[model samples]
Target: MNTADFIKARAAALGFDVCRFASASEPWSAGERLAHFVEAGRHGDMGWMETTLERRAHPTSMWAEAKTAVVLGLNYGPGHDPLPEMGDASAGYISVYARGDDYHEVIKGRLKTLAGQIAARTGEDVKVFVDTAPLMEKPLAQRAGVGWQGKHTNLLSRTRGNWLFLGVILTAAELEPDAPESEHCGACTACLDVCPTQAFPAPFQLDARRCLSYLTIEFAGPWPVEFRKATGSRIYGCDDCLAICPWNKFAVASHESRVQAREGLVSPRLADLAALDDAAFRALFSKSPVKRIGRDRFVRNVLYAIGNSGDADLIEAARALLDDPAPVVRGGAVWALSRLMDDEAFAALRSERAGGEADASVRVEWAADQA
Candidate 1:
């Protein structure tokens, strides 16, 4: 086999589900969409999107000598439907991918290994990037024939379906690029219709500010009152759109042991999660992706779900957090308590704690709940 074929074979041997190549200079039309997403302020608090647009718009702008891009996808399909967990209000629904090890580390290590093997064989310059960089991975993955960016704006394949962790390798060596796949999403809007928060404003366009994943994971402070009910039990990233994709019929559960769901992570009890102290949180999610959000924010998310749980049993869990030092956590607790108790009861509690509620943001949360 030639160098490109050899690299693909090595990638396969390394257990990557899909591997393909694309010219680094491929006319990435999605750049225009990204520009628009940022310009429209749809990215919300994600200021990084604005800062990186220039480089993300063009691969050549990122690495002038990049002659080829090797895109690889790691399948993280769930063992069962992720939707049911959303209805199980007593439990928190973590995005399937984050139930195990952090993909950034797992996938990046594999990417480096693949790049090293290629470097040894071809002796050409190479650089690898996971999601953190200002890289437009989905469009590049489509350009490489690994998958098409489904209406969910995530890479999905006929074989791999909607579950994929995309990583890219940029190389100076010129390689034969794969033919781009045409969109097969024909007459389907299941992904768009499934959004609980109506994140997708239009076909193939997502407003990140309205995305449950962004709200739960990225947007800090008190959970937005308007979206709290819609966020449901999703404490981390969401999978509503991806799980609803009809294309998922062809997908199989992920086999990567490192990426497989870790014990006690799937649909964990909201009460237990709400009780996690910082040390317990760290221990529970030591190498897991959930730890990235930190103890306060993760608890903040759990409190939102607790508020909506209506279990009433978790009311004490939410009540205890109302005095927590973290303003965001206190704010989230206020929202949870408001949901669990009536306005009269919440007002009484607010009156008692009014003096200690020193944080302005938490005060805002209190005022909103009272309103």
Candidate 2:
């Protein structure tokens, strides 16, 4: 077999579901779409996306010696449906991707191993990226024939569904490039219709400012008022659109153990998560990706979900968190109390807001509850 075939076989052996190569060059069309998305302020507080335009659009610009860009996909689809537990109000929902080990470390290690194997065989310089670099991975994956970019703007494969994590390897060695996959969305709007926040303004476009994933994980302030009600109990990331996709029927459980859901993360109790102190939270999520958001932000997200739970039993948990040191957490607690408790409880919390020195945003949240 030639070099391309050899690489493909090696990738499969290394547990990659699919592998494809693309010429290292500017992704002009994808860049144009990204530029439009950024210019519209659709990326929200993710300002890094705007600053790294050149590096994000062109692989050759990132590394001068790069000649072939190999894109690989690893399937992490769950065996059971993830939507049922989401309907349970007392249960806090975490995005499936984050329930286990961090994919960045897992995928990057495998990519490096693959790169080392290539170096030994061909003596070529290489770099591997697993979402850490500014590379437009979804576009590269599509160009490499792994999948088409779905209407929701995530990479989607017919065989693996939307449950694949992407990794890229850039090398100086020339490899035969694969043809890009054709778009399969057709006239179907299942993803758009199912979005709780209406994050997608149009087909193949996303406004991350309104995206629950961005609001819960990326945005680092008080949750935006407009999207809060739509956020439901999603504490980390939103998967409504992805879950509703018709293409998911073909998906199977991933063989990678690192991608499996943890015991507590699959559908955690809201009250239990709301009570987690910093150390306890750290101990529970030490190696998980959700820990990156930190205890304060994670607690704030839990408070929002508790507010939506409508379970009067959880109100005591929300009340106990009113004195949290982080104003963000305190503000979320106040909001939860306002939503889930009686007027007497809200009035009591409102009285304490005067003595508490909180951020201007949290103060506004307090006043809004009183009003």
Candidate 3:
């Protein structure tokens, strides 16, 4: 068997759903598109994208000797559309990928094991990478025939749909590259149309500043007034575009148990999540991706959800956060209370509390305009 065939076999044994090869040295336009995205300031507050622009342009830009890219994908599909979860305004809607254990933790060890086997068999230097690295896995995945980048700017596969978690193994060995996947998204606007924030600028482009996923995850501080209400009950990442894809019809639930939804994460109550202290937050998301945002930001997101919930029972939960040490959390509380409380009652509470707020931004949240 050829080297590519051997690697695919080993990757399957290691539990990867799809394995394909691509020329790491080949020139691709993904870099130019990313540069444009950053240049247009569409990357939002993610300064790391600008900082690593040079190294992230191509696989060879980071490792000059990387001749081949062994792209592997793991299916993490939820078996059904998670969009329906948003209907439960009292519960927080976490992105499906983050409902389980962190994908990095789940996929990294398997990637390393596969890389080691390839190294042993081919006598080649290999480096394994998950999404944490500078390597742009999606473009490489497309070049390797694993999937195509859909209009939503996410990798989509005919068989796996929008639910694949990707990892890459860059090696010095020269393997024949697989046929690249082409654009299968024809006249489909479901992903573009479904965004609550209207994050898409045009087809195949995203303005991250307006994306709820970015606002809930990568962004810190109290979100813009406009997005706070639009956030609905999404306390973490938003999955509207991913869940709305037509290709998902062929996708099945993930076979990997570790990637399945956890006991309380699927559609957790907003009140329960809003009550999480720092210690409790750490414990609840011990091995999950949600822990990275830290307790304050996560609670801030929960507060936004609470504001949009229209559930008056959660008023006490928001009221309790008024004195939170984190300015952002306190700010979020103010917004939540404004929505849940009557005008006169909210005015009385604001008059009592707004003067004492030390943070400038939190004080703004207490202003009449916010209510």
User: TM-score: which candidate is best?
Assistant: 3
Which residue pairs of candidate 1 clash?
none
Name model 3 segments beyond 4 Å from true: none
Over the stretch 285-364, how does candidate 2's per-residue lDDT look in tens digits?
87888999999999999999888888999999988987888999988988888888788867876786685754787778
Per-residue lDDT tens digits of candidate 3, residues 186-280? 99899999999999999899999999999999998778899998999999999999999999999999999999999999889999999999999
What are the per-residue Cα lDDT tens digits for candidate 1 across 31-101? 78889889999999999889888988978888888889999988988856778777688999989989989
lDDT of 1: 0.87
The C-alpha TM-scores of every prediction are 0.97, 0.97, 0.99
Cα deviation in Å at residue 23, candidate 2? 1.4
Residue 314, model 1, lDDT: 91
- Scored against the true structure, residue 313 in model 1 reaches a CA lDDT of 88
Please give the RMSD to the true structure for each candidate, in Å: 1.3, 1.5, 0.8
